[model samples]
Target chain A: MSLEIEVFATLNGIPDEAINNKTVIVIDVLRATTTITVALAAGCLEVIPVLTPEEAIEMRERLGDERVLLGGERNALKIPGFDLGNSPLEYTTEIVAGKRLIITTTNGTRAIRRAAGGRLVFLGAMINAPAVAGLAATAATDITIICAGTRDRFSLEDFLTAGLLVDQLAGQGEFVLRDGALAARDYYYCHRADPAAALKASFHGRLLADLGMEADVEFCSRVGATDVVPVYGGGIIKKAS
Target chain B: MSLEIEVFATLNGIPDEAINNKTVIVIDVLRATTTITVALAAGCLEVIPVLTPEEAIEMRERLGDERVLLGGERNALKIPGFDLGNSPLEYTTEIVAGKRLIITTTNGTRAIRRAAGGRLVFLGAMINAPAVAGLAATAATDITIICAGTRDRFSLEDFLTAGLLVDQLAGQGEFVLRDGALAARDYYYCHRADPAAALKASFHGRLLADLGMEADVEFCSRVGATDVVPVYGGGIIKKAS
Candidate 1:
């Protein structure tokens, strides 16, 4: 039998047992996972995802201010003392190269922490969809795609990003897409021709645009913008070799 | 501002607060809500929804088995000794007319009970999409559609049924679709031309086929097969007139 690929519309929607032995692919396309992929691809040494702003601050203190940069957002804006906000375009090689970054956000980081029990956890977004799907195509265990929706609710951006990955992995012809994945695959095919239009239709996409962050939406909507798949292990995310 | 209409992929995926003071629509296309709509359209008195098989038995005894029928399924098969299974075709006018039904299912009935917090709880299926959407169009509060997914996991059959409702409610031009609703509307439109094919694409639809219940699938997939909207309140579901 082929591997099973399932998509969850939100982090809270997933059962604990689904992650225990599966290869988990996490998507937060509006920004968190997208930003992580951009930061790692821009040459950041590694990113440590923290759940709260206070934890991000503490990580900065413990890792020493010289090499660790704080990057995150609260309500889609930069934290008061953080070096960067949660925009993928903000993480250029000039700023992030060779640095250890600590990040936190409203939804994405919490999902990463929740997937810690998985046999393997890889952060995915539109920018890194095919690379992440390639990882799934080679996994020994079944794959679970978890969308890090905004504030315990569904986010279309993450869901479509999950769909894009599903489309890619299913291309290997060794997958049995399950319920959510089954739905997502069809949605992906419907919107594949114009993904940016799909992203602009998302609630978070409009939320970001309302906050004058359309550039972030524009940046995150590009498929295969980079080939970096950030794998999470031992409490940190780094571009897979 | 357009009235907000949100779609939840599963009963458990929704937070308790999402249903309060809202108009909630529950769906189980394969085939709890479908069966309920069929039974009511065939002139059944009312459906008493219970959470457990034991509660169904208790209800049958308390209501006096002489006039009451036990109708439910566990794992898609008729519960042993029950009068009917969770199939739309079984509740013919000859069998269900003028009788009270105590019904339970693996997903749908529980979803109806869980939506008790809503200002109004209505059961939906492809069989009653237009009528249920008419109810939402006139609802006093924002709407929440809970898909009675299979065993806490997302089910496309319920989801596409939800999308159908979303499409119809949005047709009135006063509803603002939220994240899940936005995604659902797209999926619904994609499959609207041929809804039967869409149901056949669902995980549960194939499961029913595997179990020799293709007749139920055929029955449930017909859009607007009946216009009866079953509203659940105070522990019983009845035709909304």
Candidate 2:
């Protein structure tokens, strides 16, 4: 089975037709996807991404607070009354087990909701790039990497992750890349030499630094921290068993 | 002085702040911007891009048919009464000089109008990449590259051109790149090895080829055919002296 990989640098860059019948890999390296991956890897059962903070709260109210942990941010700061902000470090295994997280991040999780129609796979900087790449290769359908860019715009961090994934896949030599996929691979190579420098110089990175989340930038830039690949099937993103 | 380059893979990928205080370069390599650039470089005095054919007719009625040439396409095919379709080959110098061409393209020109608030520039497969790079390098303000993606979605051809422009600017070595600019350059390097393959694999490129415009694809892929850089100032696009 030939798997066609399509890389979108921003959520807005997603093609209308490519959304159908594909396994979509949603990546938001700076925080949202990173936070979710960490939360799940840390032993949180599942995370439900909502479009807005109010929607997260509403979902929480329905699911009941005892089992659900409220998470997310507004302008990179923790939401008021939220049990957690969008920090991967906050999601420790000791703090979150068998709990459902209602999350609404500034860019990442919201992008996840917009891409709800596809068979979704969530990725972040912490995940092993090779693992994500392997998952993409074996998916048996077209792979569309939807970079959950910052605020409807292209983010370098997200695109960089996509590039890394493409790079891993290209090394396998098992798949035929479309132009978008090849482009992603090239982008990864361009920034691979100095990722930290690339991250610090990005628009979102600077903004995150300005918001006092410089630590998040460092955290998200780490490649292959988790072998756990979170797959979104039927609207809920969970660790692939 | 610092020059910023904003790359848009899709109309939706446009950054919020890019709409303000930047010289916007419109790129629709499949056609639109390519056609305009070709027409102007071929000696068309001025090309007025409108959103609709009705407007072209209105302009024709108001400006008189003696000098007005109706151009553009609905689906890569020429409008019923228009003088041209959205093809670079159709814009050869012998036919377009000293003429007022009323044009409406599928994506490129519309994007230019949409982001009209910024200082406007035109980019395509043919002409003035280095000059555009030079202009961007010397520019004191941020530059936005608006890619006329296929049908409100991201097209690889346009994004690749944006990347190439970004790559050239990065090579200039005197300017610091914003994250967006760097991302565009990364995208360029990703697609630079084979522009024809990149274009053929794009959503718009396939559509054009299916409609029997293989020649247009070749024409659109030729880089640096002309050094005349088109700039949109005073609400109309013309050659920047």
Candidate 3:
């Protein structure tokens, strides 16, 4: 089995052919994957990723807002009517446990939808990189890590997270890496020792810091802080259990 | 000024919007850019990149075969009846000096045409990396480097060469790097100590060695071996006089 990592600079940059039957890991380290990982680790029932706010609202209505929490952000700010923003800190065990989250974000949800055709899709971030890599390697299928870049441009945080996952998998399996994978592995090796510093240097990181969310950047930079491997299937993301 | 390096894993992977008004550097380090740089450094008047064998033949007809030499490759082998193959070794000063050459390859020329919409396009490779970086830094425009991956698939050689160029430019100018640029720079830093060893470990490099072109790989891997920066303007690539 071989691993081919395709680093999409943005959702718009992902080729249509990239999502066919492979195990896809969607990474949005500046906080969608981190949030999802936290939610699952905190015992959330499932995270339904919707592409639009209306879909999230509709899902909330169907499931009853009491049972389904609406969570997401637009332009890094919390939606006015939503129960929560995209910050991983909000998905604490006290709040998210046993609740279903209908979420939509500026970039992460769109990337998840784009990757729906994969044989299996997993949410990956620094917080749960080892778990995701472990699951992916055991699957023994070709993997494509999609970076949910900010807006329609590349995001260094997401790419670095994907690189971290690639690094983890490279040690466990013999795989044929694509050019993007090789580049990502090199980037991971170069910045592995100082991920927090690397994240702070990114465009998205600076933007988040400007928004008074530097704490979230520090939170998301913790590699393997959680062991939850959130798997996406049947239109919802949930822990492997 | 800002530098945005968009590393396309393949020619098909490049987005149409990436070329607008940017200074684009097209890299095919395994051969095309290496050959072009060598030809120019060896005193060739110009290298006209064509997309097809017919166009090369037509250009030879238009300029007369005596003045225009035909060169390029289809699958690492010289086109039948062409004056030369896509090899830097064949571009010795004795044969190509003072002659104009029309070239086409499986990937490089296609990538150049893909980047034709740029404000200025330049050919780049490990052989002429320093020269290309110097020209790009002096241009002081938002730059985008296009890697001509092999046959619409990621080629490690081209990407690492782009990384080398990015690393060089990053030191010469103050520029905001895009995510891809940062990744490329990291990759370059990881493998800068010995480009030939890095190249030999790449997919295309292994294939070239299998085809008995180890010498070409060695020649192309030389950093700062030539001072010629080949500029593509008016549909022709010539030394930046």
* Top candidate, metric lDDT: 1
Write the residue-wise lDDT of candidate 1 on A1-241 in tens digits: 6679998888775788889989999988889999999999899999999999899888777777698999999899999999999999899999999999999998999989989989999999998898998887888789999988887688888888888898999887578889899888888878999999889878888988999989889999889989999999999998899
Off by over 4 Å in 1: none
Chain A of candidate 3 compared with the true chain A, TM-score: 0.96
Q: Give the alpha carbon lDDT tens digit for every residue of B1-241 in model 1.
A: 6679999887765787789988999998899999999999999999999989999998777777586999999989999989898888889999999999999898888888889999889999988999898987897678999998888688988889899999998887577789999898888878888989878878888989999988889889888877799998898899997
Q: TM-score of model 1 relative to the true fold?
A: 0.97
Compare candidates 1 and 2 on DockQ and give the better one. Answer: 1
Ranking under lDDT, best-scoring first?
1, 3, 2
Candidate 3 residue lDDT tens string, B1-241? 3455555444654555777788889999889989999999899998899999998898788876587789999878999999999989999999899999999999989988888888988899988899889988888678888877766455778878878888898889887777667767777889888879989888778888999999999999999988888999888898897
Interface RMSD of each: 1.4, 3.1, 3.6
* lDDT (Cα atoms) of all candidates against the true structure: 0.89, 0.75, 0.84
Task: Please give the range of 10 consecutive residues that has the lowest summed lDDT in model 2 chain B.
Answer: B119-128
lDDT of 1 at B12: 67
Pairs in steric clash, model 3: none
- Tens-digit per-residue lDDT, A190-232, candidate 3: 8999999999888888889999999999999999888899889
* TM-score values for chain B across all models: 0.97, 0.91, 0.95
